[model samples]
Target: MDVSWEESVADSINTIYLLFSAYLVFVMQLGFAMLCAGSVRAKNAMNIMLTNVVDAVVGSISYYVFGFAFAFGEGSNSNPFIGTYFFALKDIPNSTYDYSFFLYQWAFAIAVAGITSGSIAERTQFSAYLIFSFFLTGFVYPIVAHWVWSSSGWLSPSSSDMLFGSGAIDFAGSGVVHLVGGIAGLWGALIEGPRAGRFDAFGKPVPMRGHNATLVVLGTFLLWFGWFGFNPGSFDKILVPYTTTSDQGNWTAIGRTAVTTTLAGSTAGLVTLFGRRLLVGHWDALDVCNGLLGGFVAITSGCSVVEPWAAIICGFVSAWVLIGLNITALKLKFDDPLEATQLHGGCGAWGLIFTGLFAKEEFVIQAYDSGESGVSRPYGLFMGGGWALVGAQVIEVLAIVGWVSATMGPLFYALHKLKILRISVDEEMAGLDISSHGGYAYTSHAEESQPRFYADYARLQDQS
Candidate 1:
């Protein structure tokens, strides 16, 4: 098909922003790599890194081939559950750079797969993980994403319009991306069971320390930085001194999302640090990182609607929720290596609930197009909606958690019965780095004695 010069220029500009967004999302893969590697025992460091890299590779291929079609197939179907099209990319128009759009979304599919690595690290079988990654990115993640983000999705008004009164209000994927990824992690962990010695015979929890705090910290920072792009780039409509609005509405709301996301993140980090200091008798680095992550998850759903003060409130509350969830997991004997369940599932749920409670009138009006007679969400406490919005929030939380957990529980039970979810006892003892892949992150030789030397040096300095 022939194209006009102006159309070609517009397409070129859109392609640039799309590529930039893809680059930002791609950086998240490194974040997962570092975070997962640093969360596990040093003996299994190489194995964790290998899993992350390969999951991205396999996930991208699977998502590209079938997942994209299943998700945004541009169909008129009414089903709110699954997508319609089957492997139908060739028919997509070349002018729209539909392939580029697929590439960008495919990157995000792999990002979701990466979220699970930290949860099931060390004990998960390489082969089982491969199968899980393939299915998850190709079918599971994309279907949910399409439901929330695609215009033709049943959740959107353009389609069924019956199921979603508020159109599944996931502004930045509190449920579609984070919760789906976290719930999948929860299931995989339950089937695989706790790592050996992670809990005592009496079911007492044991702390499994990371090999490198440096790596973990680095990964956390990268994720925090990449999120700037993740939340704002979701608009997918970047333009000059002012980003263009989608045909749906003015996209400048993306700026509001970016600002709120930053505020919540810092505020949550500080609260977690101090909260842990009071509880654990010291400033806990791990809790601080997770707390910041909780804030990121919490603000995601309402990034464009909630006011600055509301973002602060959401951040503070989310940190507390994150710490509580971690404690709850331990008490319940759920051994999540990096606490994926708490940071993503637990806090992600809170973000969605808070959005319903705190979403402001002006922002909502700006972003959404209700019919002349349509009713709007009452302004939250700040806007005077009071108890009504909070009540709606409560319903959203119960529905999301119950739906995800119920679907996941039986799937996990079946995988356990098949014995495909976990590595054997012998393999566990040998360490996944050696047994599963015949690789080691570190060799035992001269470096093995370095810790002793460092300890001795510290003692000598103390005496001096």
Candidate 2:
């Protein structure tokens, strides 16, 4: 009842930011759909669609039911690992946040978890995938979210405790979102093994490019557009600069962060273009798209601190890093279709490390001063901060990789031992559409009465 007009306006703007961010993230679902449809075999077109569609649906339900609770849970008075209340969004205050903000975060949770589907594609059992998805969205993602973002957690803003020293700053979830998804995908890929014919008798990895490059390009663009929302919308604050006497100054820093994010992505993409050409015989559209994503991931950790030029440098380095990871993954014989291991895992780690190296102390002071105070607050390289910041980032990187690999590895191995990790060899060659899903994406052989269902119907119809 005592809220002023200014307070009301700020509330409204925060709500808008949340909604817009959520919408942008939601649009990324289409990008995933397009990207996966292109990455897999044409014969498995319908299967790819099924997996992608189910990710949004299953991921959303799981996140809403228990994922949100785990991620943002209030946690116990004693336990730092688990969340407390906030499950089912009970008793949430309308004044504290609008529906838009709530929805936006929800979309993000779904998108990050959905990335795993692409890694497990072509050979996974739909039932097993659904089960794994439920646990990931419901529990795995939430636990990590709680540790990093929850107020009560050790590393959260409330505690101001660093995972190492700089306090684990992920501006927009380079570690929380991308790294988690990538690591999960890596485990899945390793367990599933290569598709039939993807390996020779000597166990050499073969190139298994996507069935449709155009779709991959379109999906990549969609993801790029949606990232504008992903990075900029995290601020959850809208500052309208008013010259009135009542302390009317907008938070220009948020806008500056957004600009750096945009510029970093642009430069990262350019660097990737040249890097790919130099490394490979020709320029690849896929590499260009991924290079931009790598930049986005890199900038995400320190987008708020680094200058535009620094962002460009970060992007440039990430572009080459991405290329290196790709080559390394292939050399190591990792069967990562869509190269999720390189795009998210490798680049994401680089981004987190770079954030410590490049983040400015002024921004850290500003971010912390506005909210929390602590023993080892964030301090970056440009601020003449020592290697302490980098040291913290290193610990975080090791913790994430070690925990995820160790925890998920056993599960994948168990599944493999149970013979559930992969489909039969016949299924691999027959394609997922008919073998796994029981029908062609276009039309079922039994459904031929409906001529429109035929794959060749388009050409035949055109002739008619």
On lDDT, the leading prediction is 1
TM-score of each: 0.86, 0.88
Candidate 1 C-alpha lDDT tens digits along 2-63: 98997778678777777777788788789888988888888688889988888888987798
Query: Which regions of candidate 2 fall more than 4 Å away from where they truly are?
Result: 75-78, 95-99, 157-165, 240-251, 371-377, 442-464
User: Candidate 2: lDDT over CA atoms?
Assistant: 0.73
Evaluate candidate 2 by giving its C-alpha RMSD to the native, one decimal: 5.4
User: Candidate 1 — which residues are off by over 4 angstroms?
Assistant: 1-8, 75-79, 157-164, 239-251, 369-411, 444-464
Estimate, for each residue in 1-464, the C-alpha lDDT of model 2 and write its tens digit.
79999888877777777787789888988888898888887767788788777777888888878877777755342245667545547645663573565577677777765677777778887776776777777777666667666665555544545555456677677877788788988999988876778778787777778778999899988988888778877666655443332443226567788888888788989988888788777988877887887888888877876778889888998888888877787677777777777778877898888887888776665554442234246577656787877776676677678767876678778778888778776566666675566556654433653443343434333543
